[model samples]
Target: MERIIGLIDMDCFYAQVEQRDKPELWGKPVIVVQHSRRGVQGGILAVSYEARGFGVKRGMTVAEAKQLCPDLATCLVPIGEYADKADIQKYRNASAEVFDVLNNFDSNIVVEKASVDEAFLDLSIYVDNIIEKFKEGVDLILPEFLPSSHIADGHDKNENDDERISRISTFLESSQNDISLLRLAIAALTIEQIRKQIRDKTQFFCSAGIANNKMMAKLVCARHKPRQQTIVPFKYVREILKTTPIRDVRGFGGKMGQKIQERLNIMTMGEILSIDFNKVVESFPDEHEWLLSVAEGYDSEPVKARSESSSIAVSKNFPGRNAINMVQELRQWLDGLTKELAKRLVTDQLQNKRTAENLVFALATEDGRPQKTLKLVSYHPDILIDMLWKAIKPLNKASDEQTWHPKIYNLYLGATKFVPGIPTANRDITEWLNSKGKKSSDEPLTDEIVFVHEEKKVYCPQPSTSRSDSVIVLDDDDDDEKEVPITEDDEEYIEVDGKRFSKTVFKNLPVMLRKQYEHKIALETARKLKMNAKSSRKRGNSLVAAEQSHMKKHKPLTSFFRKK
Candidate 1:
């Protein structure tokens, strides 16, 4: 059985919805933004097709967009406004209406919501049925029903046009009595009825494609845009793909298309099909099979029914370097993302059944270099300020050197490893005390110390000057170096006199106490060169001599002493 796939992309979704609700803004080009601030230059969520023609694009700043077209009218995208329950219900109703209309034909129909305004429908069976009906109708309406006829004068017909006139008269008589003509009329009427039903039932204006495979069907759908249908016979599949760019094909985007072009020199789907299977595998080892299948218009991947997700993620790309102001901007984005996720979870009836585990954070430089971090949190909050802070803690510093405050362009946050936290575990005093090892009866250990296995380890070294005073007193007979059994289960805290002390306490303990308690177990480490002027002066003499000898010999250490 042949397959027909229809890719229905809405023409500027957000702008269209806004225009639909507000009749006055019908023909005007609309741009959706986050805010109307100047320096902020909020991201353009969506731009109408009319605005697109005037050089406006999604992600363009409102200020720059206005410069492109001074008359451009813009609207701030209310985050939860479009994704509200009412809006979602409306969208679902619209989708169901379209799906029901498409299901009328005898076909295996698969409808997927690609986005708010876009959906992909697999109508192979429907297309084939339509084609079969058309073929049957054509058979009925052809030569038999409309037999060739000729005009003849009575006297001349008998003499001059005897053979032709007799043949025409016989054919006309047969045409007048032909049952095929009656069947043809019936088929035509039936097609019109089907078309009318589809239009009347579903408000969505759709363009359909009838083809042998999904790829051909998709291509045919684009032949006539806005509201028209096109049918591509099985024979035209190869020719159609031959001229279409590889990027134009569904699922081929960004890096994938570039890789195909560079490795296989395949710019179009036809060229991809021409390559050998082995060569395709060599170029894209992981995705070769899938790529080949799509190239050949053979996709059997089933449409997945929507399910309640454990977590939701939202990510965004900013334009410039992330500064203090950018942090505020990130908070705003997180607020929007978290709000949307919460709304979705609540509406799906899975709110209390799940809990957000950790917030994953990622930052990208202007050139798209990314630095990612994550932090686990126990609570779900509407505003993700605490989560954001936890994620950013490792990257933040009083002095910017510890942080890569480069022109950060991208930020992302996601929750994962959700587990239901119901039926709270009973508190066990004996077990908790044993876990922390009962230090003293009066000083009850806290739960924070009890859960040591799951906590992150902190590393701090004592100052070199302080360690210099502690001299190693070795016994001649003590030849065996006792190895400390540092098991993975050991907590990061230092144990002193059967008491567990936090990392900060251990670092700032009195000098005498540290020497008495930790010096015996301390390992000797190499001294680090100070970046101060005094150290620089002393190192300068040796550096000059080393540089005179050879460039490579001192090249490595030059950057350390050089004035920044």
Candidate 2:
């Protein structure tokens, strides 16, 4: 079955959310700016269509935008001591509402949120069901059912206008015989319904594109503006590509796209489709299959209904003279960022049922941007700060001498990738436990093992006895147990049999093993006390013997008053 996919792009997402919340702000020029600590002139993150008419664009400073549009209304993203990075949780919440509306469209539909303001939906199941209904006693859907949308025919003039109903009638009449076109028609109809529900429920407008695959769906989505849907029939794919720039395609918007342009000596996607892409793209053999598929107007990649994001990051940019040259300023930013990041991780865990497997901290200077990745077992705020601070110390240090450390202009803290489940009861760990014939910590550990809540790493001093249990399970024979993630906090350590275990990781150990370590520590302390007392007694006897020997020598000097 041909897949019917739709891409939904929210119109001026952050700006739209602001205008929607304040009914008075409608029809006015508005832009959302990230708050700057220096003043009200932060960088613009979103620009409304009204603002764009006045030559305002995103990435311009608030002052610049206001200069362009005298009547512009500006709103700042949430900012505070903790959110020195400018928090966009409000927009994030708004996004959830939008996706919630989209998800409720049909039980068979699959929604893949592509970004904060974009999502790809697999509408094949819904379209197939609608097609089956047409085969039923029900007559074909009426043209009135087809709402306003673009056809994406590569025409200089838009044929889709107020007379969209007429166009829809003609299109439907033509598609009655061709099943492929009929599938697209049904998908368009479904999108129209979804868009109507979204606007009615959320008061937020979005544009959608319907096609046979993800690439076409995304390409056609931008053909129309807010509150509209576009459809690209299978027959029109070639004409659409004829005008589309290869860079405009999703994956080719960056460095890879530049290489393709130089190597293939082509700028347009259609030109490549006409050429022998296989013979020309020999250097990029890895991309051969994808490029060939694109040449044929096909993208077999499925719409991934991913619940957890690959990475969740927050960053703040310090432009121009606001760059941080002092170590203290960088430390402040790092402290704030780590605190904010910890909160984000908690939110992600509750929402996605997953936590980050690694923490990525990045620093951007004019010269270069450096990033550090460390294992993250615990999201404790203190641990995050300490680990990140230690990582940056080797790179930068403020001094009287012109230091090699570049002034930091941007700061970022984010999770690299998420672990599948919450740390409490991870499915992967459970599977591993079962394979080892060991019950989960929640269950008995052969001798009354207990599960503990989130705990910090606890380190014992290097064991004096070779008989102590190692960091792994005390008696487990598996020499190759997978290492669980642990915080890189240097302050916490517990050495058992010369092996190191993080405090947080050790806390997760079976209660039985933890008790053994505690008992051993007490025994070692008592033994140390006994050994010290014995040594002190020996020193006292040696001192008495030395004194008696000195008296026997009889060579002691007398005081000045009683010289002898």
Candidate 3:
């Protein structure tokens, strides 16, 4: 059976959400920004089409945007503002509503959300059902592209929606058994319905592309802007790919595209397809199969539904002179980011019942240095802070001759590697191993044998021993049946025959040794600190002494010449 896929992308998602909430802002330039009371201009997150006309773009400062279009409107989203408020939540809710609409379209609809603004839908099931209905002699009225107010303003006003639909429908209906053309027609009709439903309920505009696979669907979705749909016929696939840059394809946009351009000296899919398939396989050994499939415009990848994000990150950028210089400033950002992550983790735990195990902290410096990352086990807030401080300690310290402080410009904290299932009743095996097979400190061992190796003797708890039993000693097998002998000494000792043994059990040795080792470690740490301080002082003194000696050696030549 032929497959039909569609990628539906919401236009200017964040800006559109703001405009939808405020009807008065319709058709006006809008830019969404992070709110700050510090009078700093936040970078643009998203901008409306009207704003784009004025040369405004994402990642530009609010000041630059305002300078371009003084009449521009800005929506400020507060970061870490309140428990009940968030800018992302608004967009997330809008995306959820869009997905809900898609889900209600068909009982077997396969929808995969690509982002907060776009999704991929496998419309093959719907199209097959439509074909069956048509075979049953149900009058299949071809759908007309709906006339939308959100259409690009410069689109030909003379174009009629019904005429356009009739022309394409008539062309496809001319060949009844051409499954490819029929599939394209049915897919286009389905997309038209989806767009209409989305706009009617969400007051938002979207564009869609219908193709045989996701790669082509996503690439062609951008062919039409703001409330339009395009269908790529299988016969014309070569023609479309001939002129399209290889980098414009989804997976080819990264370094792989550069490598292809460098090695094959080709920049488009048409040129790539001309290369021998064996050569293509040889060049990209790892991705050979995928490379060949995509080059031939045959993508067999499936659309996977992601009900929740794999990882959640919160980051803040400090540009130019606003770079972080002090430990306190870094700590402040960490505190805020941690709070954000904590909130997100709590929400995920409640909704998905998944707990993240790894906390990744990354920082980029402004001193022409490389970015550094540290991974730690996700712990409570207090322990997390200590770990963060230790991770950043190198940046906080100074060198011997001069204070070398790094200026950090970007800070990020993310949690990943989520373990599914609820946190309760989820105990790890390592904990049991270290705890000698006990469920927890409060639980009894119960039918479990714990092997404690101490002082060349193996000890096993007797089955009759109760939960409150402590470590006890047993005599050797040679004299097991007879009573053991005792030795007279300051320390407790037991003697069997001629041999003597200490009465100190492994569990009872803590009083004599634990604190002693701890004190030794403390002393070693203190000695290292003192040595570093003394070395620093010695270097300072040597530098001063060398300067004074140089001054004495370079005595004035005038004095030796008996000044004229």
Best by TM-score: 2
Better model by TM-score, 1 or 3? 3
Ranking by TM-score: 2, 3, 1
| Each model's backbone clash number | 2, 8, 0
| Reference-based TM-score, model 3 | 0.64
Which tens-of-lDDT digit does each residue in 1-564 have in candidate 1?
A: 434454554445566556655767767878866642233436787787678789999877788899998988877654332121111333433444444544443334556555545555655444344444544322222222211222121122233335544543443344335433232222222322333444454423444444444555456555544344444433445666677788887667687888899999878887887888799888889998888767666657544322234455555555433332344545565565554443333222222334454566676654444445454432233234465666565554335443344445655666666564311121111233243343655664321211111112211121111111111111234422221224323435565433344444455433433543463233111111222333455665564554344333322211212121
* Candidate 3 local lDDT, 149-239, one digit each (tens): 1111123224476655555565456435576666666667667767877886578899987888898888777776767766676656666
C-alpha positional error of residue 109 in candidate 2 after TM-score superposition, expressed in Å: 1.0
Could you tell me which 10 consecutive residues in candidate 1 have the lowest summed lDDT? 463-472
**Higher lDDT: candidate 2 or 3?**
2
lDDT of 2 at 308: 46
**Which rank order by lDDT, best down to worst?**
2, 3, 1
TM per prediction? 0.49, 0.71, 0.64
Put down candidate 2 lDDT per residue, 1-564, tens digits, no spaces: 789999988999999989987879998999988876756657788999999999999878777887889899998887743656577766876787688778766678999989889999998887676666546323455676665666766762366455566666767777767788777877777777677767765678899989989999998898877677888888778887877888998788999888878888888877776667566668577886677678568888899885345887778777888888877777787877776676666555534545687888888887788988998756656567888878888887556533435888888888877765444432121122233344344543221112123232211121111112222322233322232333243436665434455565456543424544554456457655655665566675554454454344322111101211
TM-score of 1: 0.49
